[model samples]
Target: MDWRSVDAALFDLDGVITPTAEVHLRAWAELFTAALPPDVAPWSDADYFAHVDGRQRSDGVRAVLASRGLTLPEGDPDDPPGARTVHGLGNRKNDAFLTVLHRDGIAGYPGSVRLLDWLAGRGIRVGLVSSSRNARAVLGAAGLADRFPVVVDGLVAAELELAGKPAPDTYRYAARLLGVPERRAVVVEDAVSGVAAGRAGGFALVVGVDRGVGEPALREAGADIVVTDLADLIPTA
Candidate 1:
């Protein structure tokens, strides 16, 4: 909770820094609802929170499939969308998300941007850690591509063989990139998995931005503090 003691801050991309979570939510709903058979229950927001939110694309697809007692081949990452495999389904979801992103564009949350500016003014280092492979593209669309010097995203996780959120590896990797120890850094997350990651990494502080995930859930997931907005953390000048 002591801001002065923190050397670096690691942030989650979609729900925390930007409102792309809604975009992701809609895309996932569309993909799964269309894929389900007539007798199968339609995909719902609860399903997204449980199986897809804050997870890698293919991993989310596999989890969702498992939930429905279905399984698919682990197709190549380069498999085209609609190829009828895990990777293909994930790719299809990505395509849908991209379509929405390109059509509607995106902007960083004002509170999040305010927090970034506050951290910058304090000379604190910043990094982005996200399970989304589209982190870069989303950041670019939101005009925040250059704000973070280090981004530990799904692409980098695959390259380094780091486990995704709830594992802490990506957050730890980002701290290392920022030349800070895990205990000297803070993590801002909006997802349960991400808060768990920060806790598992032994970071100095895990701040949860409760977008839709309840405050109690965030705390149970290991957040040291929970706020409705990052603006709450900014110091009065």
Candidate 2:
């Protein structure tokens, strides 16, 4: 991966660093299962890969509903759960996620943690870049709050008025915050939209961690390389 050329590394939160993607997928399923009608196509993991993964909560809500030929108003962020608005559904999903998170705390992937330790040993700056607003909570839950000095999640993105993944703005912003130029930073991601964003940002390299999204899709989405696990990237003596 031309590690010698990289000055910083940016990682997507849920699938790449930790298994929180499972929690998020369950939340999304719960929201859509209750929202979709009996005759309509049931919510499936495919919907998650296609519309929800790597998107901001509200954007994901709109995309999933659009795929089902359903439209909801862009309700305020404070909209109550099950209120039948974009933000409401997003909030409902968040509620489900928080419930699971609190019930069962998260942990980072061992291989990913090993890579982080290896990168630290090499003195490379690392940052967490994610579309999820709950990134901070998840990072803390995984007990990795200290590993990343710079984080550009949904909250920071909104505060900076940056666009989310599949747009490249968030990834670009993370690089800037880390004081690393686009050509000197590496982006590691597990979602198609995230791969596309890294590609659009013209980073040094985009590594795709295939959790569920297939290799061809990630490669087509602009991943420079694809591996089943981050552990594979570590060199052995």
Candidate 3:
């Protein structure tokens, strides 16, 4: 990789920098397992990859329900959990995620930290762009909040009226906030939709981290390169 040409690195919070994606998967499974019709297949990881990963929370709930051919009202964001509406399910999943997160805590991948340190040594600015509203909490719990000077997450997206992943607005916003041009910014992500967003935004490079979401899917979505871990990108010398 041409390290000199890269001015900034934008990372996805869940699967890339931390393993909170697993916690999210567990939360999603719990929500769907209890909520889906008994005849519907039990919620699985594949459903997450296809419909939930890298999407806004409410949007994910809507998509998952649509996949089951079950439609629900677009409930208010403040609706109580399990209210038989889209936001309710979204809220429920968030609540479940928070329960596990606050109970057990979370941490960043060692390899990811290595890469972050490498970038710091090189003066390459770093930012975080995530679909999850919990990005701040996750990064804080993982003790990585100080690494990123710029963060663009679900809450920011809603406040600024920026589109979510599978769209590039959030990434673009981060790059802009980091004071870097897209052509000199690299995006690291684990989800197909995220890589697709990088591609759509015409960033310098879109890096795919194959953390359960397969390499082929990420490549198809336009990842310039794929790696199993961020440490693999560090200079061997």
Candidate 4:
């Protein structure tokens, strides 16, 4: 990839920069397995990739529920964590995630941090575009909050009514915030939804980080280039 040609880079938060995707996966499994009726299949990683990963929390809850022929009220965002509504279940998952985060802090993948440093050295602006509402908290726990000047996270999306991943609004918003056009910015993501968003947004390049989703899947999702790690993009000194 020609790093010099891109004016900015947009990155996803969980699987792309940090391993918090594991934390999220565990939380979701616990929440859904406990809540779902025994007659329904238990939540699994496959379910997550298909219905939840890279989506907003409440949206994820709806998707997962719909997959299982279940439905819940679209409860208010302020609904308590244990409420039975969709927002409530999503909140419950958030609580579980926060407990894990506080118990065990997070760190960015070394390769991702290396790429961030390289981009900084090149004076290429970087923004975070994530469907996770806890994006700020995760970044703070990982000690990486200061690295990104623009964050188009779930909170921002909700406030602005911007569509989440699988839609291009958030990524386009991030690029605009960085004072760059979609065609001049690159997107780095680990989720198929995120890759699709980048492609839909018409980014100059969409680089997929294949943490577990597989390279072929990323390519099919519209990633221009797929790598196992962000360090693969670093230019040799």
Candidate 5:
């Protein structure tokens, strides 16, 4: 399929564009390990690719917890960032991520940059939709904040009461922000849930970046095209 056929490109920020995705996974693993038990299998990259990345913070926390045959109360969204509940734990993970981001700074996925530049240069509208509250800061730190003309992130999601991944709301919002019909926009994602959301949104294309999501798994998630990286989609010069 030709990526250029789409009128606009909607991307998930973490694994799809930013190297900070790994930092997020590492922080999540550390936080989950400390909160859970040593006997529990540590959260692996595969697990993160499947369950955590691209998901909303509370949803990710719930997914990882469920993997351990455990459940936590769905604390109010108003719960303080560190109030010792499920929301608190999610906030803790965010804090860890911020520490890593501040210390290490931000980095972009080269493949993603290649694709974004190609898309932008061709005059295709581009937008970023992420389930992360820190998406703006991450982009700013990475010097990619202005590359995307539209950003619909976690804070906006919360403000609009949009459901996270596996729900079409976030991607739909992005398409609207880009002033493109959903059928004319493509959703580029690296997580299973994100692909599901794109499919549910009826996007013209769902390009899955199999960064850690195994090839077969992404195809099964309804990705219209599955590649190891976004560089695969760049039009040849």
Candidate 6:
């Protein structure tokens, strides 16, 4: 796909920019398994790949509970950090994720860096658009926070009342932050929900980095092009 028409790029954080993706998966697994009742089976990888990977924290908790034929009250977002409700579960996951991140410093995806550099060199404005509230911290730790001049992360999403991935709001916000129209921006994602959001936003290009999910899955999710790595895109400079 030709990205020439795109003047800006919006990127996801966990899997797209940093190795925190694995940390998220692990934390989810831990939280889900611990939350399961004594008689319930443990959380599986398929459960993660199917229900939670790309969703918001509260959404992820709800999805996993549904998988086990369970339900919980839609607790308030400010529900004190550990109250046993949906928000509580989400907070627990966040705590676990932060622990892992602090222990293991962020790792950058070489392919992603190459693509970001290429875009920057070509004068294409770039922004980091992620559902994670810790997007800034992750990028800062990885020494990449300065790479993108504009950042529209979970905090921005909350402030703008924008829905997360699969709703097109976050990507649209990022594009807006870059002062580019949706049709003139590219959204690069690794999650099914994120690619769908990009496509729904009518971006000039919806590129998918199929890190774990196969290429066909990404294509099916509305990615214009699926590449194993962003390095495949030659540097415009």
| TM-score (all chains, Cα) for each model | 0.97, 0.98, 0.98, 0.98, 0.93, 0.94
For candidate 3, write residues 14-105 as lDDT tens digits: 89999999999999999999999988777888999999998999989988998988999898989999698999999999999999999999
lDDT (tens digit, per residue) of candidate 2 on 17-130: 999999999999988988987877899999999999999999999898889888888989899996989998889999999999999999999999999999999999999999
lDDT of 4 at 59: 87
Per-model C-alpha lDDT, please?
0.93, 0.93, 0.93, 0.94, 0.86, 0.84
User: TM-score of the candidate numbered 1?
Assistant: 0.97
**Candidate 5 regions off by >4 Å?**
38-42, 78-82
Model 4, residue 216: distance off in Å is 1.6
lDDT accuracy of residue 232 in candidate 4: 92
Q: lDDT per residue, candidate 4, 129-172, as tens digits?
A: 99999999999999999999999999999999999999999999
lDDT (10s digit) by residue, model 6, range 1-237: 566787888888878888787888999889887888977667887777778767788878888888888898878887865687999888888889899888888868897888788877889888988888888889988999889888888788888888988899888877877789998888888899899999999988898988787788889999988887788866445
Residue 65, candidate 2: Cα error in Å is: 0.7
What is the TM-score (0 to 1) of candidate 6?
0.94
Question: How many clashes in each structure?
Answer: 0, 0, 0, 0, 0, 0
Model 5 C-alpha RMSD vs. true structure (Å) is: 1.8
Most lDDT-accurate candidate: 4
Q: 4 or 6, which is superior by TM-score?
A: 4
List per-candidate RMSD values in Å.
Answer: 1.0, 0.8, 0.8, 0.8, 1.8, 1.6
Model 3 pairs whose backbones collide = none
Per-residue lDDT over 1-237 for candidate 1, one digit per residue giving the tens place of the 0 to 100 score: 468898999999989999999999999999999887776677999988888889999989988888888888998999999899899999999999999999999999999999899989889999999999999999999999999999999999999999998999999999999999998999999999999999999999999999888999999999989999899998775
Model 4 lDDT on a 0 to 1 scale = 0.94
